[model samples]
Target: MSLLEHLEELRRRLIHSVIYLVVGFFVAYGFHEKIYQLMQAPITFALKKHNLPTQLVIHNPVDGFNMYLKISFMVGCIVAAPLILYQVWLFISPGLYKNEKRYVMPFMVATITLFLSGAFFGYRWVFPGSLDFLFAYSHEFRPLIEVNEYTDLFLTVILGLGISFELPILVLFLSLFGIVSPKFLWKNIKFAILIVFIIAAIITPTPDPLTMCVFAAPLLFLYLLSIGVSFMVHPARRKRLKEAA
Candidate 1:
């Protein structure tokens, strides 16, 4: 296909993505209350589990409305992500060779699975742990966190963790495309570690070491795992890998 044809295809997919997002925004906005309750559930459960105070307040006049709007937008994006990814895959698939199509199904599945895993990890483990730690210490202080501040912090953590968990897939793709390889990464392990610490410092809002480690540890492990995947993807395997390693 010509460059003009590819651009046209991209334009169609972009339009489809926008339509999905618009539809999703309305559906999600209608259920914003339920979503807010769901979002607060983990924090509520944590406080109850540890017998800590559980009230979060919003002092500003418009904070509540703004929070609801933000939540709706976020929820809409999450709901529409699959449709966007599908459009993206469709747009790119036409250009791939027949042999490459064999891997497309597995790649799509792995990508979505890894993303959901990250979201679950952030919600189920990291969110509660940090919230509990932060609030448990303030039991006697009449804890009153602003709703906007709390959700902003919580949502950022959730999104950051979810995106970070996509590290393995990103590494695998980079390796598959020969952008980087296992041997190079292995040689620069120390530098990678430093970068991990730096990313953790930047991503996690909390100053607590444990919270930061929760983000950093899996990233390091995923990097190592990506090396194995990179080796697997090279067309000339076994002998080439042995020589390269």
Candidate 2:
């Protein structure tokens, strides 16, 4: 395709993606109350466990509405993830070989699964642990969590981990495009470890060592996994395997 044609195709894909997101947002907004309760559960659990008041404070009347909108938007993103990924595949497929195009299903499945895994990990373990540790560490102080602040923190942990878990997928694309290889990833393992820990420390809400390690450990594992992903997707490896077959 010419440069103009490619640009136009990209614009079309972006428009489709936006439409999917908007539809998902409207659908999620209908259940915003339920979504809010689900999000609030962690803080509520922490507050109750600490024997503190379970209510979140809001300085302004609009805070509650805004919080709900944020929650709905997040849910909308989750719902739209598959379609967005498909659009991504459509955008890039023309650049891929026929054999590579066959990976579309696995790519979509892996991307969604990995993202949800990361988000669930944050919700199920990291976020609650951080909240518990924070409240316990500040046991003497009267705690008043604001609605918008809490919502921001909640989304940060959830979305940050979700995006971070796409490490393997990122590596897959880089390998498939001949940009990186398994050997390079393996050789640079030390640097990857350092970068992973740095990202973990930055994203981890709590300043605790344990929480940081919890965040770093999976990322390190994923980096190792991404090396294997690189090996599998790297053009040379794929070409060699096909010739052998």
- Which candidate leads the pack in TM-score? 2
lDDT of 1 by residue, 23-126 (tens): 88988999999999988888788778777667768888898889999999988988898788788778867755456667767877777787778778888888
Displacement of the residue 173 alpha carbon in candidate 1, Å:
3.1
Per-model TM values vs. the true structure: 0.85, 0.97
Model 2 lDDT-worst window of ten: 65-74
Query: Per-residue lDDT of 1-245 in model 2, one digit per residue for the tens?
Result: 99999999999999999999999999999999989899999999999999999999999999899888888888998999899999999999999888789889999999999999999999999999999999999999998899899999999998999999999999999998999999999999999989998999988999988899999999999999999999888989878988998
- Shift of residue 243 alpha carbon in model 2, Å: 4.5
Query: Which residue pairs of candidate 2 clash?
Result: none
- Cα lDDT over the full model 1: 0.80
> How many steric overlaps does candidate 2 have?
0
Which 10-residue window in model 1 sums to the lowest lDDT? 233-242
**True-structure Cα RMSD, model 2:** 1.1
